[model samples]
Target: MSYIRGYDPETLRELVDARECKDRLDEIGEQRSLPALLERVWLLKVLGRLEDALVISEQSVRVARMAGTRKDLLRARILHASVEQQRGAFAVAEQELTTCAAEAEGKGWSGIAAFALQHRGKVFYDAGDYDAARADFKQALFLRQDSGVPDAQLESTLHAIEAADQRRMRASVAS
Candidate 1:
């Protein structure tokens, strides 16, 4: 998401508006696909607007409940956790991720479950609980190893954890 280019500040502002337009379907009583809602939420997330993302995503979660699609609910839950993480609500984010992962574990969505674990690990890392973060990361790594996800992204995530650990250690030494 961060890799996408040409999302200049002006474009981001416009995009934020567009996403709001799509997100307010209740005003028009016009139906929107779950994917459409998710896309808007994702764009808002990439724009670094976590509050907006949370608003739209919570609406989407309600819609998903009405739609009664387990998969859609799963996606919404994961995305909601991600937005909370972006807002630095680490405990709330971890709770959401943990709930989603537990549900996914029983429903044969281990890949999605693993993704939730990554989010959980990130929250733990940001909260400076690296022991818990390492456990979550190790579990996620094992899942990804068997699940055949693209290795490059996982490698980058691992490296991010490593870098954060290094920084924390340096800060401790300096203290």
Candidate 2:
């Protein structure tokens, strides 16, 4: 079982107790394993410790490059870009995610491609580019569907699409 729980589908932000995350982090102390580092980065990001998250995320990317497979590197890059995105480095996150998505697709890794596209859509959504966000989400949904991912994963993209549409409608109405 995973220590992490209750992350928002659209934003991938944790909705569980911060104390639980802190406890998990403590348990993972001094562990430099890729999974351990990735968990630390995620917990830090969710706790609003963006600087620490960024540093750890970069380290995770380096570790993945040195010891992990290409897929692992892509996942690490995606996580690092997410930290960048939360740090308000929208352009950097967008560029990285775009590249990750393209690479995943080229490698015939539909699940990884969908993951990258979903995150890229979030970057666009956070930047107020709802149309682009929706487009990416749609593409991700297609990929996920084609890849026969679980219902929860498909629902996440579906929820994202609905959210983008709602936000777009709201912006138009307010304008």
Candidate 3:
């Protein structure tokens, strides 16, 4: 029932199974705790339920604001920005991610900053800004390396960098 195995960035399908995601959603039904809401938002987003994800993400943000620490609120905001990115709100997502990354960096939260940078890179990639995406991914990789994150996490950023490079090359060739 755990979804961690289904989140592999290196996989062709990104390791997500829609049916499993839906089952997890059902299992988390009406659980309004912050962690539950966060998980629900992630499941809904993965299930391609963007509107529902956005709603749940917003509620999670509100909950974090009311009952969580600054780090928790930032994490919620980062997740919210990711949903916005997936929903094609590139500008909004980028702005929020920029702010979040800056705050996290200022606080010496390398892992959080790397996470924000990685997600921001995805926004850039989706928006066809491959240069920016690569830059963000590289920065995230550096931060993660400095923090001695697991190899799997490092591999994710490395894959992102390669993807951005490939896309940029393809775009230039087409141009």
| Candidate 1 local lDDT, 1-175, one digit each (tens) | 2333322321111223544544443343423677767776766776676787899889889988899489789888898888888788888999999999899888977688878887787777777776677677777777777788886646745654565566558667878
User: Per-residue lDDT for 93-124 in model 2, tens only?
Assistant: 99999999999999999999999999999999
Clash count (model 3, backbone only):
0
Q: What stretches of model 2 exceed 4 Å from their correct place? A: 2-12
Q: How accurate is candidate 2 locally (lDDT)?
A: 0.90
Q: Scored by CA lDDT, what does every candidate get?
A: 0.71, 0.90, 0.89
Q: lDDT score, residue 44, model 2? A: 89
Residue 107 lDDT, candidate 1, scale 0-100: 90
* Candidate 2 Cα deviation (angstroms), residue 77: 0.3
Residue 152's lDDT in candidate 3: 80
Give the clash count for each candidate: 0, 0, 0
Descending-lDDT candidate ranking: 2, 3, 1
Q: Write the per-residue lDDT of candidate 3 for residues 72-96, one digit (tens) a residue.
A: 9999999999999988999999999
